[model samples]
Target: MTDRRGLLIILSSPSGAGKSTLSKRLLEWDPSLRFSVSATTRAPRPGEVDGKDYHFMAEEQFKHDVIEGQMLEHAHVFGNFYGSPMAPVQAAIEAGRDVLFDIDWQGAQQISNSVLRDFVLSVFVLPPSIAELRRRLESRGQDSAEVIAKRMQKSWDEISHWDGYDYVLVNDDLDQSFEKLRTIVTAERLRRAQQPGLLDHVRNLQKEFEEISA
Candidate 1:
């Protein structure tokens, strides 16, 4: 039987390192996973849907949640309000489905520090190099030089903290990186800490073994 304590998979990478793309791919490929939609004050872009792409709310509403302790982890990034809402994530976890987090190290640390350690597994994705990161960001063609420079600078800060993650995968090749991440997720699901019924399974097997010996 598959392990069933469920999971909180944190996928963090600086912009253009492919964390978001990999996360989306993982969710689409794995039926047992449910993507965690973050709550934010940022307005939705064209072709982005509320509650699906994100739980877009006003800054006032987000601040209310933060004050009321309704957020599992919330942070201010690049002058925007962003947070992982408690209710939906909790509900998903309790239902025995994996919940994916496309959040930064700070938010991940907060969740881990709050004693939700057993359910959380964090992975840091790294680009091949600073040069490759720059090329990839430029290839996206979505940002101005100033914005890209900001992200490249931010990447230096984010990538320096790679040691904090449970697993680190370098994205030199997309297919290989995807496989590595997939394997980690599957392996984590089998960890004894997350498998609630492991003791029961062991006990039942022990009984059978003793009966045979008798």
Candidate 2:
């Protein structure tokens, strides 16, 4: 195995679409997958680790990275700036570890347009139904009724771009969705584009074949 670079898996979904939850489950089940820790200007919630849950940075520093082109993709959500930094992601790929991106459509576009595009595997997770999405949002209890309403309003806009992704997983159930994600990751690792050294490997096998006949 060449240990060639791994997929830049991008999963985007509206709030309550179960993407984050599903991402957690998939990583739990798969040891090789690594989550991309985003940099955020928002204050960390309880129990969140600085480098694990997010790399909390000051707004000035966040803006500085954006200005300097250090971010792969970034978006402002509810008054906070959240972004994926370029260096760490590129370093991970160069080290042959699969990096995951849990970003929205706008960020996904920014990433897909960058050099990382060649290695990207974009997956959009969709709610099974609007009703189910509303139900899930309500259960979280962190959002007010007004905020939940806003989230529900944006889901249609978010999911409308489903066709742009390489794969779509309907997150009706957590375990099933994780399996679907896992399947995509596994299949992409064997894709021809990921294996430029394949021709050489095959040529060596062909010589062995000729030797057998001789």
Candidate 3:
């Protein structure tokens, strides 16, 4: 069989909807999957590794790249710039390696409508309830009360875009949601359009049958 084209799998959600954790789990489940490391102008967090967590860059450089059309999708969030670089994503997909993106709805919308839309599989994760969402955010202990309030407002905005995604999951339980996510990936990989080699395989089968009949 010929190599199948790689999928651009995107996961988007509100701040406390468990999208990040699920993304990590998916990466662990499929080691060959390439995670789309985004470029950002924000300062790195305490434990964030450069290039691994994010490709931290100066604002000037980031704007330069954006102006040069190197970014696949970008957004200005919370006074900082964040975007997916096109070159790395193209290289990975061309090599038949699926690329996973953990981004917000704005980025996802840009990519979903881009020239590479055919290869995109976008999923939106939703929290079970607003109350639960707040609880999860508080549990993290990473944000101050003010920041948390800001995020809560932003979360509502994010959740409003849920209908834009190809797949939607209400993440009431982590394990079940992950299982559903895995199933979606598996099914998408098996899609007829994703498997270009199927045409050749079917043609070969036809030829073999004709030869046997003769």
Candidate 4:
């Protein structure tokens, strides 16, 4: 049996950069990959489900979890607390199941610096251009004009962290970007360090070869 460790795939992008769409396609491409559901202190919006979209938590509880070191990574954004729970991530990786995270740069930084940093593969998605990003945000029509402006204003802050990621992809075409994303995942999974079973497998082969030579 080939032993493998799960990868912590973190995908980040400013709103409307097609991160969400790429994430959906990645999940569809590989059902074995698990999504890392985040915990948030913000109220659930319409159509959002608890434990699905987020594990909606109270501010106090969220703070407590952070203090207790139960969060793999966390941040306060837009006045709300958001975090990835540590336990599930630890569990998934041990079971050799890749865990995917759709989070911001802050959370990605936190995870990249965590104890399990070796397992993380962080990717940053960028729009082809700021103007195109604005157009996509506007086309969504889910936010008010004021909110869209605010998002655009903060987009630079997000883009500034592009260098922090292991890989950065400009989402000019969704299909092309997704293909690259898949290739990254596939290559990461094949790393020698990830295949712990290879050591034993090689040892067995050596013994067989020695017997044949004798």
Per-model lDDT:
0.87, 0.87, 0.93, 0.94
**Model 1, range 1-214, lDDT digits (tens) per residue?**
3436778899999889999889988988897798888899988899999998889999999999999888879888778988888887677767678899988878878777654676899999999998999999999898999999999998998988889888999999998999999899889888888787788889999999999999
- For 1-214, candidate 3 gives per-residue lDDT tens digits of 3468789999999999999999999999999899999999999999999999899999999999889988889999889999999889888877777999998888999999877899999999999999999999999998899999999999999999999999999999999999999999999999887888789989999999999999
TM-scores of the models, in the order given: 0.86, 0.84, 0.89, 0.92
| Model 1: lDDT to the true structure | 0.87
Colliding pairs, model 3:
none
Candidate 4 lDDT tens digits, 1-214: 4399899999999999999999999999999899999999999999999989899999999999999989999988899999999989888888888999998888999999998899999999999999999999999889999999999988899999999999999999999999999999999999987788799989999999999999
Off by over 4 Å in 1: 1-3, 42-47, 58-61, 78-80, 203-214
Tell me the deviation in Å of residue 42 in model 3.
4.0
> Per-prediction RMSD in angstroms?
2.8, 2.9, 2.2, 1.9
Model 2: weakest 10-residue lDDT segment is 1-10
Give the candidates in order of TM-score, highest first: 4, 3, 1, 2
What's model 3's lDDT at 27?
95
- Please write out the lDDT profile of model 2 over residues 69-167, one tens digit for every residue: 999988898899999999988877776678888888888888989878999999999888999999999998899999999888888889888888889
